[model samples]
Target chain A: MPIIEVRNLSKTFVTKDATVQALKEINFEVEEGDIYGIIGMSGAGKSTLVRCLNYLEVPTQGTVIVEGHDLSKLSGAELRSLRSSIGMIFQGFNLLMQSKVIDNVMFPLLIHKVTKAEAKKKAEQLLDTVGLSDKAQAYPAQLSGGQRQRVAIARALAMDPKILLCDEATSALDPQTTQSILQLLKKINRETGITIVIITHQMSVVREICHNVAIVQSGEIVERGLVEDIFTHPQSRAAKQLVIEGKDPDEFAKEQEAKSKAVPILHESRKIRIVFGTQSSFEPVIANMILTVGVPVNILRASTMDVGGTARGDMILGLPADPASQEKIISYLKERGLAVEEVQ
Target chain B: MTANEINMILTGVWQTVYMTLVSTLFGYVLGLPWGIALTVTAKEGLHPNKVVYRILDIAANIMRSVPFLIMLILVMPLTMLIVGKTYGSTATVVPLVISAAPLIARMVESSLNEVDHGVIEAAQSVGATNFQIVTRVLIGEARVSLVSGATITIGTVLGYSAMAGTIGGGGLGDIAIRYGYYRYQADILWTTVILLVLLVQLFQAIGTLISVRMDKRHI
Candidate 1:
């Protein structure tokens, strides 16, 4: 059975001037022990959707059934208890700046009336799991962003929650720091079998850790599937954009506006994106393809990306103006097990 | 100066110190919770109640708007009921507390409001009760600001305590009035003024030091 199930969930925010529908009929299920990623742009309602899972923001129109309990139907105390069962961490780390790391982690346990000694032991163990046992007495401001996030993770896990919700948890960290945090999360998920629901705008983050992903756009789930599948052959515009940008965000952004002129100018005939999974990445497929086709293909962009920890190579190649050579190259590349799609 | 005059000045110092410290203590006793209520009942607060917030809001505003001297006289009957007199340093405490509580409430509300919203959300996510969020997250996070507000409150209350001298409320203000203004003793007036300044500075320095030390937000 799915651990979390959302059906026809909609959230509408009514202000004085406007009634904004932040989420529209969002539907998805997170299976037990699954790492689910909800990816979107800034205003894509990913945060709102995550908030709905915990009922931090109640949905206006549907049911959220977590662990067989319809969240909206639960009483105040029952809801609170349910909330305690699900841990959440944020992009900002949201730690108590005044409290020591140990104290921050112990906060939820103490709130649940756990004995100080017992809570302390548990907090210490969690800190060890997150690799911050030595920094127990350190204040949050004294730690770096990555360290602070680890403390937050320790605190979230203090309750031994069945599910962990991460809302852009690594957006604030640098690339290396982001990788370390993601690795820590992956480790925790594996060891504890704790289901994790990650909400992020960065497709790279999803590709790095999530097994399944749902792409949100303007309060709707535009596309969703296995991370590898989406990376290889994105069917939706939102998914395709995210996939393309996931390779090089800065260049992709420039490419968006410049796409109208740059594509035609750069290549007179045709351009195709070839995505190679880990198996095909090791072979010199491109080199062999050039020799086999007997025509030089312009490498518009080539980079190897991390797709769920496995290296996947993606390249945008400009095919020759001659139709026969373009067809031959396309057919040859298809025969090699590379996922190819024409780039407009 | 005669030994008798010096002794009287010393008594005045004692009276002023007694009133200031006592009034500040009572002020926080009433103000801290009052401020918390104002904050928690606010529109964006934990258990936002428009009715409770408005009542508290209006009451605090009214108490703060009335000038301290008028409040001293205005609460004279209440003070007479509470302390059986409206003139001594102890009786002056009644009106001083009345005035200080509301101002402290405003300060406390502001301090608690300054706490990051994200921190409160984190606390709520962990299923902390509203009361727990108020006492632990909001109050704990705003401790530095609360201390700083208390310091400022102490200084303001001390100044108000001196103003009580206009009536029969006793303190250095009383001494300065009787000897300095009534008898035209410039030295006594300057001495009382200097002592009051020193006292204010002393409280301020101590408060600042405590606040700075308590602030863990910085390195």
Candidate 2:
């Protein structure tokens, strides 16, 4: 069974001027132990949607089922108990700046009335888990952005939550810090087998470690699917755009060849598009083919990028000067499908 | 001035100190809870009861605007019922506290509001109960600012005690009005003013020192 089931959830926030629909009929299920990512631009309601899972925001419509209990129906003490099991982190790292790192990590446990010594021991262990064992005595302001986030992650996990809600948790960090934080999150998901709900605008974030992904825009979910399937065969406009930007060319040509038909694609009139993959390398093969045929070649646009440790490339080419030249280029790229775009 | 007159002035200074200190203590105690209630019932708070917030807000404002001397006279019946006199230090405390409560409460409420909303949200997200958030998160987060508010409230209440002269409360103002102003004793009048200034300086210094000591988080 899915660890979480959200059905047709919507929320409207009323301000002095007008009501804003923050969420609209969102439906999804987070399978147990899956690092589920909800990607969106700011104001896309991804944050609001994640908050609803822990009752941080009450949904105006729909229901949340977690571990066989409907969240909307829980209240007061029962609700508190429910929240204890679902940890949450925020964009700002939200550590109480006034508090020491250890105390901040110990807060949730202290609130549950754990003894001081015990809470301290647990906090220490959690700090070590996030790899900040020595900085427990320092205040949050004294730490670097990465260090602060590590403390926050430790605090969130202090309660041993089955699910962790990361609301743009890496958005405020530097690029290097963001990567480290992502690695830490991935590690937590792997070792502890915790489900993570990551909300972010960076496609690279979803590509990093998330197994399943959902894209939201303007308070509505636009697309969702398994990470590999969506990246390999995007069905949504936004997903396609994301995949294209992250693609690499030589690798892409090879992938296209894998998906190519038995009939040779060599034609004087047709343009060749190359898809890049992670392992695609600098090859003179395409140029060599044109040189061998004594035909002039034209290059349009090309891009190469690696995501999830695999290089992806996409390149568009104009017609070669002759039929044999095009045929030679097609066979050349197709022969290297292991490093180029497979046939699509 | 004669030794007798100087002694009377001494009595007046002591009276002012007595009234100021007692009223400030009462105001501080009363204001803490009222301030907490005001913040909790505010729009974005945990239990945002609009009606209760409005009523408390208006009552505090109306009570705040009333002059202390006038409030002393206004609450005469209630003061007399409680203290059995309308003209003594003990009787004066009732009206002084009544006047200072809302001012202190508002000061504390504003201080609490200065705390980062993120801190409170963080505490709540961790399954903290309302009481835990207030005492542990909200109050703890605003501790330094709250101390500064308390200091100001005490100083304002101390000022109010001097005006309790009209009610025959024997403070420095009572001495100045009854002896200096009535008899045209310029030296005594100047002396009382100097003494009050000194008192205010002392309170302000202590307050700033304590507030600074508690403020570990600059933001």
Candidate 3:
């Protein structure tokens, strides 16, 4: 059985002025040890959907079955116990600012009624796993943002949870720090075989650590599959936009506008935009095609990036004015498994 | 000042301290729970109950709106019933506590509210019960702020204790009214006023020291 099966889950938040549907008919299943990513812009209900897995925000409809137990049918005590097995971290690194690092890690263990000595011992071990054993005596405010998040991770792992939920866990940190935290999360997943779920607006984050991904848009899952499939062939408009932008949409639009005025228009030639997945992007397919078919290709606008530790590129190639040569080049690219689309 | 007069002033200081400290303690006894209830019953709270929150919120507002002096006179009957008499330093505590409790409750409620909702959610995610969240997360996280609020409450209660003197409640205020205003002893009036100011400063200093020691944010 899948470790977590969410079926037709929906959530709506009601305020005095209006009722907002935060999640609508969301359906997904998490396998035993998959690093699942829920990717979306802000307000896409990614956080709400993750929270509903642990019942932090109760679903408005449908059921969540974890480990053969329907979460909606469980009693309060059963839910609490289930939650203990499902650990979650936050974007803000919500460590108890008042407590020492050790004590913060000890929080869940203490809540679970573990003896203080045993809790302390277990907390120390978890802190060691996160590589923060020396800073156990320090308060959260005394540490940097990255260190605080490490502490939060330690605290989350204190219960030896079966699943770990990360709600934008590295969003607050700088790029360098985000890389290190993602590495740490990946390491934990590899060593422990714990199922991990990451909710984020940053596609780069999902690309870095997630194996499977679901693209959420306005309270619905628009697309979901292997990270490689989504990155290589984004089927939906939202997924395509995410693949193109690779960051916040607003900022990307602003950046594109700033560069737009300075760039010259394309000349009179056939333009083909090809999206190369990790495997195809690295191979000398373009060079081999040019050498064999003898079609001179002009690169108009090309950008290559690493998505999920694999090289992928969105390249717009200017083909020769001859219709025969353009057709030959398109056929060659398609035969090699590259997703090709004609541009104006 | 003569030695005899200085001893009288010292006695007045003792009485003022006694009334302020005792009343502040009792005030918290009632107000802490009142504040917790206010926080937990509100719309955004852990266990929101509209009717309970509305009633308690309105009651706190009404109690706060009444000036301390007016409240003292208004609660005289209940004060007398509680303490057998409504004059002197010990008896004055009855009315002083009643006035300070509502103010303390409001302060406590605001302090608890300042605790981050994220922290509370973190606790809940770890399978913490509502009681555990309230006691360990809400109260634990807000401890520094609670202490800071308590300091302000202590200072305000000291001022209210002096107001008790107008109704024959013993303290520096009683001495100031009888020995300075009535008898035209300007020296006695100034002496009591200075003593009151010094007492407020002392309480403030001590409260700040304790709050600083308890604060883990800076260190």
Candidate 4:
């Protein structure tokens, strides 16, 4: 069973004048150690969805199952325990600014009534993991934004949660910092195998760290699939647009040429999008005779890339446009067991 | 002034200090919890209760609106009932505490309100219970503002106690009123004026220093 299962979750907040449906029958499952992402534009109900996952914003309808326990059914103490079990980090890095870094990291453990020494020792290790061991004594204000967020991540990990929910955790950060933080998140995922659910509007964040993504739009999941599939052949217009918007011109052009066809997973094969430039366009001809071709060529989508360099622009095309064409392209494209979906 | 006059002023100064300190301390004990409740039960607070909030708010406002001297007189029967008589420093202390508690409570409530909501949210996200959040997070967060408000409370009550002089509170203010105003001792009046000014300055400076020091988010 998945570690976190959200089924038909819906929430509507009523003001005096009107009722706003924040989430509409959202559904998904996150396996243990999966870096699941919820990608959306603002007001797409990403916040509401994630908040509902932990009962922070209780769903008006449907059930949220975490570790086989329905969160909606929990009472006062049980609910708090449930929240503590699933750690959360925020874009604002919600550290108590007046609290020292060490105290902030130790906060959750303190809530659970752990011994002071034990909490302190765990906080030290967690802070060290986030690369802020020297900042234990510093207050949030005394540290930089990245440092503050690290503290928040460390604090979120204090209870040794099985799942981590990141709500726009890096939206406020610069790109370089975003990369490093992404690395840290990936490292956390690898080392502890903790299931992570990140909510963001930025697709690059999804591409960089997430293994699976659900694109939320207007209170519903429009598309859901593995990260590589979503990146290579995004089914939804929004998801495909996000992939293009986040990648380089060459990569995007390759996707446009491919027009992101129905690679369809065709049985969950590891897919790679190989973009051919001026230098590598003939590379496929070298492998055609060595591999098997399942069907005759049918163009999925193609476009030109303008990287503005010696490569100038390269024609990018989706090799297999449909279920019928996929097998032919796959056998032909495979070389030395290199199974990839070449876009350009 | 002469040495004898300085000696009198020094003793009166001690009384003034004693009155301010005792009244302020007692006022804080009574007012802090009231202030915290006011902030915690208002519309945006942790546990909002409109009925309780309105009643507490109305009571604080009514008490605050009353002139300190009139309140001292009006509450005299009650004061005597509690303290055995309406004379001397002991009886005066009761009225002084009464005069300042609401004032300090209002000050504390307003100051606490000025604290950023972000801080409260941060505390909440950490799984702090309401009581722990109040004492540990809210109070600790608002400590600097509360200290400044306390300074203002002490300073204002020092001024208020001068009006209490008619009842023979006999602090430095009473000395000023009886010796300077009633007896028309110009030098004594000037001397008391200087002393009050010094006290205000001292309180203001110390308040600012502590406030600045305690405010870690300093920006």
DockQ values per model: 0.82, 0.51, 0.87, 0.30
Question: lDDT order of candidates, best first?
Answer: 1, 3, 2, 4
lDDT (tens digit, per residue) of candidate 2 on B1-219: 889888987887788778888887888788788888999999987789999899889999999988877888899999889999888677888998998889888988898888787677777778999999888788877888887887787678778887887558878888878777788999988998999898888988998999887665653
Docking level of model 1: high
Give me the runs in candidate 1 sitting further than 4 Å from their true place: A247-255, A258-267, A281-284, A287-293
Show how many residue pairs clash in every candidate, following the order shown: 0, 40, 0, 5
lDDT of 4 by residue, A166-278 (tens): 98999899988888898999899999999999998877687678878999988999999887656556667677557646543334546667866646554432223433446
Q: Which 10-residue span in candidate 1 chain B carries the lowest summed lDDT?
A: B1-10
lDDT of candidate 2 over A1-344, digit per residue (tens): 99999999999999999999999999999998999999876777888898899888899999999777798787788888777788888888877766789999999999999999999999999999999999999888788889988998998888898999998898888889999999999899989999999998787788887889998878888888887667766666556556654532234445667857456765545665666555545666556656765676566667654445565666767755567767767777677662232222
The candidate that wins on lDDT is 1
Task: Provide the lowest-lDDT 10-residue window in model 1 chain A.
Answer: A245-254
lDDT of 1 at A273: 94
Between the candidate structures 1 and 2, which one is better when assessed by TM-score?
1
Per-residue lDDT for A1-344 in model 3, tens only? 89999999999999989999999999999999999999988888899999999999999999999888999899999999999999999999988999999999999999999999999999989999999999999999999999999999999998999999999998899999999999999999999999999999888888888989999999999999998888777788788777755677546656668877766665567787788776785688879989978977998878877666777787879888888888999999999999887655
What tens digits encode model 1's per-residue C-alpha lDDT throughout B1-219? Answer: 678888988988898889888888898899889999999999889889999999999999999999999999999999999999888899999999999999999999999999999899888899998999998999999999999998999899888988999897888898888889999999999999999999999999999999999889998
Q: Which digits, one per residue and each the tens of the lDDT, describe model 1 over residues A1-64?
A: 8999999999999999999999999999999898999988887799999989988888999999
Model 4 misplacement above 4 A: A247-282, A285-344, B1-5
Which candidate wins on TM-score?
1
DockQ of candidate 1 is 0.82
Q: Which pairs clash (backbone N, Cα, C closer than 3 Å) in model 3? A: none
Per-candidate Cα RMSD to the true structure, in Å, reads: 2.0, 6.7, 2.4, 7.8
